[model samples]
Target: MSWSIKNWRRNQILQREGIPDYIWQKLISMRCLKGLNPDELMRLRECATLFLHDKQINGAHELEITDEMRASIALQACILILNLDLDYYRNWVEIIVYPGEFILDYDYADEFGVVHHIHRIAAGEAWSAGPVILSWQDTIHTATRSGHNVVIHEFAHKIDMLHEGANGCPELHANMSAYTWHEVFSQAYAQFCHQVDKRQETIIDPYAAESPAEFFAVLSEVFFELPLITQQHFPSVYEQLALFYRQDPAQRWR
Candidate 1:
């Protein structure tokens, strides 16, 4: 429907049931929401409320999902889509939260057709047209730490999967060029991988060198957390992300 209809519905719902003071306090304490203006904050709250209405933030591993936890997760997830719309996340409906890192055991075949079973631990995962799973511990650590945010990382994958698969590129705006995104990200990813190979100290996460898709997801964490560093290190990618996400987080932090 239209923006006005969505806004009116959100307002009506918010009027009846609003965010609690304690939950808002926890969100402010996280520091990521610090520089948002009053209007932005209000919109964020509205977005978060609609998120709660649309998606299920359920706790796994017998972990009790509290209202505070729901609000906190919604606040973080909504921040990424503040300038975008809820429609961007249309495919996802469930957010599974675990107490800590979880393990997944699966089997895969090699080129020789040899079957191998492996177990891997993951902090968060976003399956195309499926749920976004996260670890509550890692999610909380993002508030105090730099260069980390599983929520943003996984959500970035969802954004990347919008057009197709998560291939380091999200659906670019009319102003953004596919050639520019490819040229910039390819060069930066190669350079970062070189630095990682040499075991040099780097500002961006070394895990970013894993693949183009992971690079995109990891840089998304840095884009929201250490905006200055991301901009300073990879100016072109930062510009593209700023254009796509439609937020100058560096300016917000400043």
Candidate 2:
């Protein structure tokens, strides 16, 4: 879409289908959204409104979707792109929400190029150029936990995939250094993996150790929900994320 056409559509959505004031207020008051100034809050609201207009959020497995549920999911999803652009989330529209954890049965190739069939439970999953599947139960509750938000985690993957394939690096801005991003995240990922391998307790989720992609996604959850922790433990990584997302969440938290 051309910039002019997109801007016009966004304006129309903002004027015609704005979220109710009460719902918007409630969403902004959430812990994950803390420290947003009035202007940032307004921009976030606009982005979220456009997000809801663009994306299709559906309930699965007999789960009924509600307006509040939709707003809740949209608000969190928009937070990732609040400082960026809604186009960051383009090419995907469906957000499937289940009542709770869902079964994921699929085949995958490991490092050895051997294919394996695996069945497991997942709270959320984001596909490249595809739908974002989430467990609604985890979505609402995990936000309150220390940097454990399923919505943010999955959506972060969506953003990461925008670059090359969610390998812990996304498309960088012109001013941002790709080399710095790689170095910082690679070191952080290695340290985090070692800690997890030793079974040490970590404020960041151990799931990050799974891969570079997961490390980026999981840390993104912490970066938004618990900025202080992210800044404290992995300062360089936090700096890189701040540059990429174009938001100073740590400063906001402070």
Best by lDDT: 2
lDDT of 2: 0.89
Model 1, range 161-252, lDDT digits (tens) per residue?
A: 88767899989889889999999999989999999999999888788988899999999888888888889888988998898889998898
Positional deviation of 226 in candidate 2, in angstroms?
0.6
Model 2, span 8-54: residue lDDT tens: 97789999989898887677777778999999889988888889998
Clash pairs of candidate 2?
none
RMSD of 2: 1.8
What is the C-alpha local distance difference test score of each model? Answer: 0.87, 0.89
Superposition TM-score, candidate 2 onto the true structure: 0.94
Q: What is the TM-score of each predicted model, taking all chains together?
A: 0.91, 0.94
State residue 202's C-alpha deviation in candidate 2, in Å: 1.3
- What residue runs in model 2 are displaced by over 4 Å at the alpha carbon? 1-6, 109-113
